[model samples]
Target: MKRLLLLGVLLAVSSTAHAIVIRHDVDDAKYRVPATEFPALVDMPGEGHGALIAPQWVLTAAHTLPMHGDLKQVVINGAARDVERVVVHPGYRTLPQTLIDQAMASGEAMLIVVFLASGDDVALIRLKAPVTDVAPVAIYSGTDEAGQIAKILGKGATGTGATGHSPSGPNRTELRRAFNTITSAYDRWLCYVFDEPPQALPLEGVLGNGDSGGPVLIERDGQWLLAGQGAWKVVQGNVLTARPGRYGQVTCNVRVNHYRDWIERIMAEPAQTTAVG
Candidate 1:
């Protein structure tokens, strides 16, 4: 199948992708964080990522899973855990790649917007056994995400705002964390922009290739809460001029608060007779 390249809809690929695109002036090492700092962050089937929200439940993007197959395992805290079942949101839907490509090629902004709004791109994975070593992260229930500083963690493609996503692709072994302020908050999405040098944060950055389903966190009191999950990017120009993770680019993540009830409902139910792939 052809990869869904537009809207930053990352699919599983064999090549290693890079992570966070930082400011041109900032040292790349500053964004490198230890695994212990985010133990709940787990590796999904491919380059995608998910967070442990409950002992045996993982929250991730619905698009990250295969359209027709079983998800056998997910790596949590460096260990593989058996996946008992996968539950995709009832509202979730997959658009044809040809339609997405045609819209981008024609610069049909309206079509792009309609396609993005068509589904709730969220999912949950129930593990066969609970992970005792890692502490699960909490979901942010508040609606005031705008103006808040968010810490984005991923092991995807890396580059600078001046140059956009690297031609070198991803560095899978290096996990990085970067900060960005939420520019806007919608009912289903939390948006952030990649600011230029003088206005950017110390380690300011945005998502690149392979970051789908990764976590976007906001601190409340002293604890970090999961506010969003990396889903797609809204570029300002046509397909020819578009550069993923470049300056002024906006990333729209799946708002966790909006789907809190759905997550709760899925986790509350007993094991399903069949898993949704």
Candidate 2:
């Protein structure tokens, strides 16, 4: 089964945060790295969504895994490349229990059963070869707040906008997703329309399927930073019996600040990560 992810912090979320169309826990195994960065990430068969971060790294969604294993590839000219290693946020959990407790502690606890926050969805692919093409987007030292306007790019929902079965015998898809990813999900979930500006912020556009793992970037004082990772959408279905129709709502991106210590700790041991075989 595919894994899932999301974001909501503060030990517990406010009750109002629960009512939007939230993102479910679909595996972001489709995180595609560029050849210049590393070989194509495994599990992701085709042109998966990716963005350059540095000369030797590419960032992608954490769940983009392989049917058989977990080693993100680097792609170039439609050919698979090679890689040195990968560094994912240590906080990432295939089934994170702490995150679940946080979810349950809040009125939005169900968000945990389905997915975690978007804040930790990022995965960095370190390449044996350095990429000179696409430049890495800055990994912000800070995350954006509720009303900041940000841009997101990624492949969107598939199969006529409804779910379908993969035909690649569980290894790949006979019908690959057209990764024409676009705008980030707007404030429909995090904040209401009237909530925009002055102090409270809101999403500027719409978000949908295929946008998972996309970057939410915001420029503060003319400086760019990685604000959030697109996680899940809240769709009130049979599971949410109280609500009949899926409303406009979103999950969350876990705070980047929450994982700074973890990331720094891992990066401090670069040799160990590079030695992964």
Task: Using lDDT, give the best candidate's number.
Answer: 1
lDDT accuracy of residue 170 in candidate 1? 49
Question: Model 1, stretches more than 4 Å misplaced?
Answer: 1-3, 6-17, 104-110
Angstrom error of the Cα, residue 70, model 1: value is 1.7
Q: Model 1, poorest ten-residue lDDT window? A: 7-16
TM-scores for every predicted model: 0.91, 0.54
* lDDT by residue for model 2 (145-252), tens: 554555443333222112221111121222121111122333212322211122222222222333344455566678555554545444333221222111233334
Stretches of candidate 2 exceeding 4 Å from the true structure: 3-50, 76-81, 96-122, 158-204, 221-224, 239-247, 272-277
What lDDT score goes with residue 199 in model 2?
24
> Compared with the true structure, what per-residue lDDT tens digits does model 1 show for residues 1-277?
2123423432211111457778988888888888887999988766778899999999998767765678899999999999998898988877667765675567544555566666798899999999999999999989999999999998888788997774335435478999999999988888889999798887899877667788999999999999999887765656444556779878888899999988998899988757653
Instruction: Estimate candidate 1's alpha-carbon lDDT, on a 0 to 1 scale.
Output: 0.78
